[model samples]
Target: MMLAFILLPLGRMFGQQSPAMLATVAAMPDVQGAITLSLEVAMASAVIAAVFGTPLAYLLARSQFRGRALIEAIVDLPLAVPHTVAGIALLFVFGRNGPIGKIAGQLGISFWGTALGILVGMLFVSIPYMVNSAREGFASVDLRLEKAARTLGASPAQVFWQISLPLALRGILSGVVLTYARAIAEFGAVIVLAYYPETAPVKIYELFLSGGLQQSSAAAVLLLSVTLTTFIFFRYLAYGRAARKGRNQ
Candidate 1:
């Protein structure tokens, strides 16, 4: 009920938007670009996070090495850090004067004011979702299965690919979904690092500053509609997949 109170008013407000304003928002060319940029960065970030986070998650799940706790803490550090602080930290390391930026510059891969910058920021904040989910998934799988595969002449890589990966895929998919949501919703870090590309959130902020709540609200509603639709669709897809697997078994 309390949640309804908070959300109902906003829902009503969007529901009450004048058709002309809705049309204006829908017709804007940059709206398409903003959507494209948001999807592109979010998808890229999710892919990168899955690739890098999977290895770390696997280690965290399987290893008993010293400093494993420390590594886990470092992996989750972004959750504790403010987005602005994370942005600045990223900038310090990837900015023109920074070491990585110099290497990037040589390859003509600019970060500032580019899609790559948005991707980096998105990955920074969303990776924990992928890592944590994948780690838990890996942990849930019985080690005996992996050991049995190994005893059957499967190499380490083969054991992981055939046994661990398939069993852990559900959790990995969930992580990708969560990371995509997080990346799409990112505002502060992306604005600091790559504002010119104008993701949906940044565009909403810019509209609010330049126009007012009405214009900004229109964009906000659009973003909300798209995000909510995607979220619901994926949730249903995940549920359906689970149900199908259960029936097959």
Candidate 2:
């Protein structure tokens, strides 16, 4: 069933594209620009997620407080929301007349029809993968190790930086990979928010709309190749680290 639904279509998509067609599509300035933008923005989104979401993930893993469940639910809400709906919801806060947008406009920053808008859209949908994966990572760390470090006069910051963070690195790295993949693949929200500085997904969509299947298929395959290569490389790194850590232990 999985092969039929997933692998079959993917195989067919790749099979339909010749190397010459792929090279031609890859050579296009617009395709190159769109793919580059997608990679850059997605990477930025992943970094931002790690910076902000890590602490929140740790908090969720280590502490219990009022509304903690609610917080977790809220963090995971994006996964449940439709991307188009998420875009519309974001526009309320980031649109030109919206509060943040209005304030940002005064500072000469605009979200509408810009890379910032695309970043915001990608971040909105992809952050859950980061937070959830990181939370699980943090949760997996043994509490006893942190307690032992504390008993030995380690500061909370020291314990976190030396113990907790290291132990949770795999999960955090996995979250980052997932977040990047999700961000790069975002279409509806990115398209709604910023269409000019086209990301690969948006560009492929445009190709499909304007030039039909043959044109779009080549670009789609190119994106698939890039995404798959990156995903595999990161996953290998993560797995290699885990294997080394296990051997050391």
Candidate 3:
């Protein structure tokens, strides 16, 4: 059933005048703009998620602090939360009329109707994937290896840089891939928060609502192709590296 649903659209996409469809979306400014914005904002948010998420993941995997469970729950909240609700929550904090928004306005850093808004929306929706992937990665690291390095006159920092980080890198890379994909595909939160600078998903909705299936399918197919291609590339890199390591072992 799942394959049927998936393959049917793919068939239609290929069955159509694919070259013309590609050319049509290629010529549309809104389509190109949305694609560019989605890629740029998604990449930026992925970086942010990776940087902040790594330490949090390490802490979660290694520490046993009070409220640790709560922290984890918070990290996973967005997955269950309606992103439209999340968008509303964000608005109350980042909208020009909102409290944080007022303070940010003083600094001339806008969130509403801008890239920052898209970044926040993407980050909120996608961070759990990064953090969880990294946490699993960090957890899977053999502490004995870190201990061995430490006993070999290596400091904690050295052990982490040389042993733990490298060991967990595959998981982190996987998380980054998931983060990037989620961010690019985000719709409701981004639409609510950063409407003018429409991301690809929102643009697809716009085309669909205004011009119907024919107009929208081209853009949607292009975005899907781009997303799927990038996803496959990353997956190949991550798994191919792992396969090589396994063979070496």
Candidate 4:
């Protein structure tokens, strides 16, 4: 926290020019495009991760199947690998020469340096957060409640929707937020796979390389501000809902 505060002022002092920095910001088409694309891809990636990951998380939570530990470890592989290595692995699967990418290309859907690439990068790095959080949430739910519902002749889907999901939604939401946050801040993988679309982190890196410290720091501050604001708002919303449910209970 102290380091963050220290960096903020130093970043501002070095980068915040009188008016030129503001003008540079306004005139930065690349930066603007990057920011827009980042948001779009991050949101899409988060949604996709949640949809696929939720069922997997549910299974992980409810069952003690063979290789359960292996599955869990596999889910966390992204966290263990270097970000750049993850990008390279994704490229092997999603590059133009890659089998999936080749098929996608025939269908006019490309991944490299496109919005799809951004989503893939975000998904690659951030999916573990959502899956793990949701699994934990589901695990916290009372198995007895589900059993009772089953005994009452509630359909599987009905029991899940009426009992399990409601009980685990907070955890799911927390995971979603963390995934989104991770996606938003992803740099190495995104830069390697989707440099053309240019997420905020890439833009900052470019500015530093091409322009200078002052230019890059300004962009960094802007990115930080946006991320911090969005996180705070979403966190408050999630916590408030949890609190309200607690009160009702």
User: Model 3, range 39-155, lDDT digits (tens) per residue?
Assistant: 989989989999999999999998899999999999999999999988888999999998989999999999999999999999999999999999999999998898888888999
Q: Give the top-scoring candidate (lDDT).
A: 2
- Point out where model 1 deviates above 4 Å: 1-6
lDDT of 1 by residue, 1-249 (tens): 999999998888788788899779878888768977898789889888899888889899999999999999998998999998888888987888778988999999889889988998899999999999999889988999999999999999998898998888777878888899999999888888888889999998988999898888888888888887887776666566856886898
Return the candidate ranking by TM-score, descending. 2, 3, 1, 4
Runs in model 2 lying further than 4 Å from the true structure: none
lDDT-sorted candidate list, best first: 2, 3, 1, 4
Error of 2 at 230 (Å): 1.0
What lDDT does each candidate get? 0.87, 0.94, 0.90, 0.86
C-alpha-based local distance difference test score of model 2: 0.94
lDDT of 2 by residue, 1-249 (tens): 976998998999999988888888899999999999999999999999999999999999999999999999999999999999999888999999889999999999999999999999999999999999999999999999999999999999999999999999999999999999999999989888888799999999999999889889999999999989998888877768777987999
Sequence-dependent TM-score of model 3: 0.94
Report the C-alpha displacement of residue 18, candidate 4, in angstroms. Answer: 5.3
